[model samples]
Target: MMKESLCEVNNLGLRYHRGESAILQGLSLSLFKGEIVGIRGENGAGKSSLLKAIAGLLPYQEGEIRMPKEVRKGLSYLPQDLSLYDSLTALENLIFYGKIQGIPGRLLKTRGNWLLEELGLSQKSREKLSALSGGMKRRVHLASALMLRPSILLLDEPTVGCDEESYHRIRDLLLKMKQQGTGMLLISHGRGELEDLADRILTLEQGKLREKCISSD
Candidate 1:
């Protein structure tokens, strides 16, 4: 029997402003459960835009996006831009996002602490985001995204600016999530990382989607 797709995008099109040429045009793809789908392309190849559309962060002008309603309920997105509160600590940031995501109060506290410890931020849990380095901020942002235990994860340049240790931690965590049957849409420019982690690689060029098979080492 064939595996059911967690996500499907067909003839998707989007433009930032009216009459502007579509940033993403006729893009189509399917992502299955327990798979890490990587989107790779040049700087302006609409990789980020495609992710935004799938994540419901951007409105598309055309086409269908199909997903299990339950999976859609569990979707979590981490954008390339950092959006943490400058005055809040790493743990506080996680708590905020968790609460907003409807995580129970008791579970939020417990999960926040656990995530901070796991991400190696326990020592600086009280330090304000303003005091953290760029890499640290990125880690905090990623931690917030993981706090909800999302079944479908959409990550845009998740490892960008991360230190080597932090990068490995994030990479390993993603692998573990995939093993647990989480569907992922990963956008990255790093060929090495994509080659190592993605189950299927999709390239967007001139508004077209192409799949590239990658060997798993």
Candidate 2:
């Protein structure tokens, strides 16, 4: 069966400043429905830059990102840096994000509560984000990203700083999302995590990308 293309990056190019080294050059990739694509690279290899460009956070100097208008409405991006507000409670943060997404107040409340419970933050729903541990904060971030039940997720190290149980919960959630046909572009330093979750993995180096062989051992 042919896979449906959710997003396409064609010959993308980016640089922080003119005359400086290019961060990404002539990179092309496609994400398909229900697929998990893993990106691996050393520091400064522009892994995060690529995701940022795709998410419309960073503007690429060359090439283009193509997606259907409807798909754009369902896209979600989770950066490596925490994007949540420290002063807001977990539920409040979700409501804030959900509202921005235009979710109705009644529906947003229901959705926020559901996500907090699913990510194991139900007990801490009213706790301020700053009062939570790193793992808890990460979970809340995930919950906020999930508020819209996004069809495409650009996740940058989604499990970083997570406790063992929280890590497993997230892994299971990703699998479930995949089963539900959510396409994901995931970046992780752990090779085993990529091998287990990604249908295929791509390595980024020298501002380019190449398909990598997965070890069976």
Candidate 3:
């Protein structure tokens, strides 16, 4: 039996200005539950734009995006840049995001603590974000995104600036999420990691998407 698609983008097109070239043109893609789909492209190739559109942070001018409302309900996004509050501690940031996602305070506290511990940041949870190393801050950002156990996760260059240990930690967390039926669209320029981790690889070039098989070595 074939797996059902969790997300579908049909004939999608987006342009920054009217009558200008489309950043994403006639693109169609699908992600199935429990699958990790990697998106690869050069700079200015609209990879991030595609992710933003899927996350509903950007509007497309044409085509349709079909996703289960339930799956989108707690959809999480980690943009290429950090989204945490600089003045907030890692635990506080997770709590804040959990509240925004409507998670109960009691559950938020449990999950936030577990996440920090899993990400190797339990010791630093009380420290302000301003004092964190880049890698530590990125881990906190990722933990914030995982607070709600989102059904669908959109990660844009999540491993950027990550140290080896942090990179493996994030990778393991993503794999664990995939096993728990969380669909993901991971945008990255790192071909080696993409090849190893992505179940299906999509390459965007000149406003088009093409599927490529990746050997997970």
Q: Identify the candidate with maximal TM-score.
A: 3
Q: Which stretches of candidate 2 lie over 4 Å from their true place?
A: 213-217
In model 1, which regions exceed 4 Å deviation?
A: none
**Candidate 3 similarity to native, TM-score:** 0.96
What is the alpha-carbon lDDT for the whole of candidate 3? 0.90
Tell me the tens digit of each residue's lDDT in model 1 across 46-108. 888888888888898999899889988889999999989998888889999999999999898
TM-score for each predicted model, relative to the true structure: 0.93, 0.93, 0.96
What ranking of all candidate models by TM-score puts the best one first?
Answer: 3, 2, 1
Deviation from native of the Cα of residue 212 in model 1, angstroms: 0.7
- Score residue 16 of candidate 1 by CA lDDT: 91
Q: Candidate 2: lDDT of 170?
A: 81
Report the C-alpha lDDT of model 2 over 1-217, residue by residue, as the tens digit: 7889999999999999999989999999999998899999999999999999988899889999999988899999998889899999999999999998888888998999988877788899999999999988888888889888888999999988788888877887888888899999999986478988888799999999998756452
- Candidate 3, residues 37-153, lDDT tens digits: the string is 999988999999998999999999999999989888968999989999989998999999999999998898899999999888999999999999998888998999999898899
Clashes of each: 0, 0, 0
Pick by lDDT: 1 or 3, better one: 3
Candidate 1 TM-score over all chains jointly = 0.93
